[model samples]
Target: MGCATLTPVPEAWRSVPQAARITDLCARVSCASRGATDVKVTDGKLVASGKDLTPQFRAIQSFDVSLERREVAFAAKRSDNFDIGLVSLDGSDIHWVPEDPADETDVQWAPRGNKISFVVHSRTGDLVRTVHIPTSFQLTADFPYTAVRALGWEPAAERYAVVLTSPEASERIERLKYSGEGRESVVAPAVRLDVAIEPLADALLMRPSTLHYGERLPLIVWITETPFEWNDARGALMRNARVACAIVRQPSEAFWTAARAVAWIDLEKVYVVSGAPAPSPAYPGAPLSATSVVADPKIPTGRYRVDDRIVRAPPAIVESVAAGWIAEQLKDRNGPR
Candidate 1:
């Protein structure tokens, strides 16, 4: 007897089949850069300047930057619960760059471009990873702990700078290098700068204000929450509410200020920090003051606003591929009827 006649598979059955495979969907989608990486930081206080900061950025988030004025890279959140994105643009609009399967957060684009580094919040603290653009490849940057004070890269030096936190101890900045096939990371070990911002570390967050890669060795400016010390019996338990900025050069160069935000007015002869309270730092003659024409954006920013619940358009081939897969599966199930 011949096999029974095969009718169109019901929607339920169609849901399970395989369609034509899409080797690479990234090649199909295209968009221009809207300077997703154009984050402006001037010498000023690190306080919010009433800019209706995005909710996602209210907490810990990545700083945005264009590899240059022409190239920009950023991370847009795809879901409310997890951050799963890294995208780029060349002055037009942003195109999605792929992410590692592991859940990642605290994303930052490398100053050199075509690469981004992020932390994977895992059971064992935070694991750092670097995503290579256009290829969607991931390189693990092994960090000992999950708490990151600041993260940035100086491609010219062939190293990355990271500020790590030790809640029970001091906070330090360390440089790392990547080697091996997967670019496994190795810490410089001895190269580190240790600074303490106790109460601030507890109440607020930390992130690289920006890292300057220019003719001289790269310098990193990091924004830390209000500066706090031991609150010795001689003074109040907490310092007045204000932001702290740290400018560091690998060989133990660190500067501090009680500015509301910072703007790189000159960065060499004179650095600016605005909204100063009688030239703060409270050290009588500390070098923090409201001195600059540029206003700091408070928090680093990107060109586009990311919708927490991204209503994104999936790849066009996705449906076709799924449909094709389902049809093939249906064909196999029903045989040659």
Candidate 2:
């Protein structure tokens, strides 16, 4: 027998009304311009831009954007001088925290929204400074260069990675440490470069992550044949070109040996590669290709299939493979329920 038709409820009767509705959160955006070197953002209906500006250089640098305080901050170099400044995003107000006339490199936003940290150079020597904000930001103190280079904040900004560079060149991996202000101590030593530090695509390329999210990651270091004229060494010489990664993180000492590669697709997203490379010829030198390229998410197995003939992996496939490997690591580390 066929079922009987039932009466349907009216649209007005079925619809439910809420006592109150929540509005959307305001978006806080900040950007830096080359011509002005000014950081700007919008606060509510008003637009604000910062001052104490300088000409932008080709090097990749970043600034802090505080939505809570509605301000933009960045480091600037003028007359061979480095300084940090905060200003309204609309160009109405400006505040400057200038550094001593010295070489300042790798200025970055502190994990906290209210402070900035950077490498500073003075007549005495090179140092690192962490500056407080709002109630007049200023340099708090100077830390050793080793700590400065390895300085990285934890996910929550509460802790930092502290690395020490040894005076001896052979002891490259012996220098890195991870700790807070009062508990400074070495966490790992004799770490391999490929395993110790991972490079971020945006940071290594000297470009913003937003613009290069899907682009191929560049090689941080490569062994390429050097021109004979440039090299005084008699035989065919190969030189290592060091490229800095955009972001770096220190994993627990236990997992250090298993780690093989580190990469960043965007500011917040990170991917680490591990496990042994496939046997050579069939898989080549490293199971992974020479260059760390960004991959597409839709690919099979989350890794790139190499075309051995050209000795190059497609950028899109590379990113996908890296992403897949990272996903697998997360699963294994987290464990299944």
Candidate 3:
């Protein structure tokens, strides 16, 4: 039996219903483009064709679709200006987020699609930042933050992982839980988030948990020239060795590590990135970055992959494709899709 029949796999997986719904949506969109609009009742709107109306967005550098929210959050850049936005699946209006994305910022949707976080460029430097999807409250780290490598969370969970490199170049993974708003009798309500980062790897490759559910966060690895020594979060900072095999090694070599799917290769069947061309490998040496990546890989273990070839896509194009996928996967189901 599938842990989730509608879903399974890393940044990638083989979802039958997902494809069927997407195909049907595409057909409807094709008809709409030809001026034959046929509307269907879905949890969310599906915009297969037309414009999302964010003309200023030059390219969608990082993006993800939230099937639960029926929306897509993305970071797009034009010249030196970068903006973040939340767009519905119906190709309607684009709602601008208040986040001031640094060149390094990549919009991330929470596993539950309730929260969003990213790195922000401040006058001092870069900082780890977060914003709730509903309330739109923002949180910024006080310290001198450098970059956000990856973020992960357990399915339907409040606890999340934030991997980062300090300005001094030290790498750490912060285990965090959303603490909601803080209110005082005198002051207005403010957002509060609890975080504790343990110095885990000098270089850790994070295959973050997906917006859709899986058993748990995927098996992350410390990069090296040889086969990966899995870095399960059980050995995370302050954790008192739940598993005896939790060996800790300092990161010496920095190889680019990313995941097409969040689960380990053995756990989920690898699925190819559908509706994508052959990977161009164009984003070479851009730095190890991962935010909200959605993929379905149907390949074997030890062959993890992601569709970075599409990273160079214009913001509208990426948003369009991702928005469509989110809308199609928005069916009411028992399993994560």
lDDT scores in order: 0.34, 0.34, 0.37
Could you tell me every candidate's TM-score relative to the true structure? 0.34, 0.34, 0.36
Report the C-alpha displacement of residue 19, candidate 3, in angstroms. Answer: 42
Per-residue CA lDDT of candidate 1, range 80-110, in tens?
A: 4345343223223335545445456666666
Candidate RMSDs in order: 30.4, 20.3, 19.2
Best by TM-score: 3
lDDT of 3 by residue, 21-71 (tens): 111222221111111332221222223344333454455666666666767
Scored by Cα lDDT, where does model 1 land? 0.34
Q: RMSD (Cα, Å) of candidate 2?
A: 20.3
Candidate 2 per-residue lDDT, tens place, 1-337, comes to: 1122222322322222211211211111111211233353222122234432333433324455555565666555444454655656544445767656665655555554566666664432245566666554454344322333334444454434433331111111111112224444434333213212322221111222133344433322211121101111101111111122222212233222222343432222222222223223431222233322232243333224333211122332332233332333234345454
RMSD to native, candidate 3: 19.2
Task: Give residue 82's lDDT in candidate 3 (0 to 100).
Answer: 62
Q: Model 2: what TM-score?
A: 0.34
Pick by TM-score: 1 or 3, better one: 3
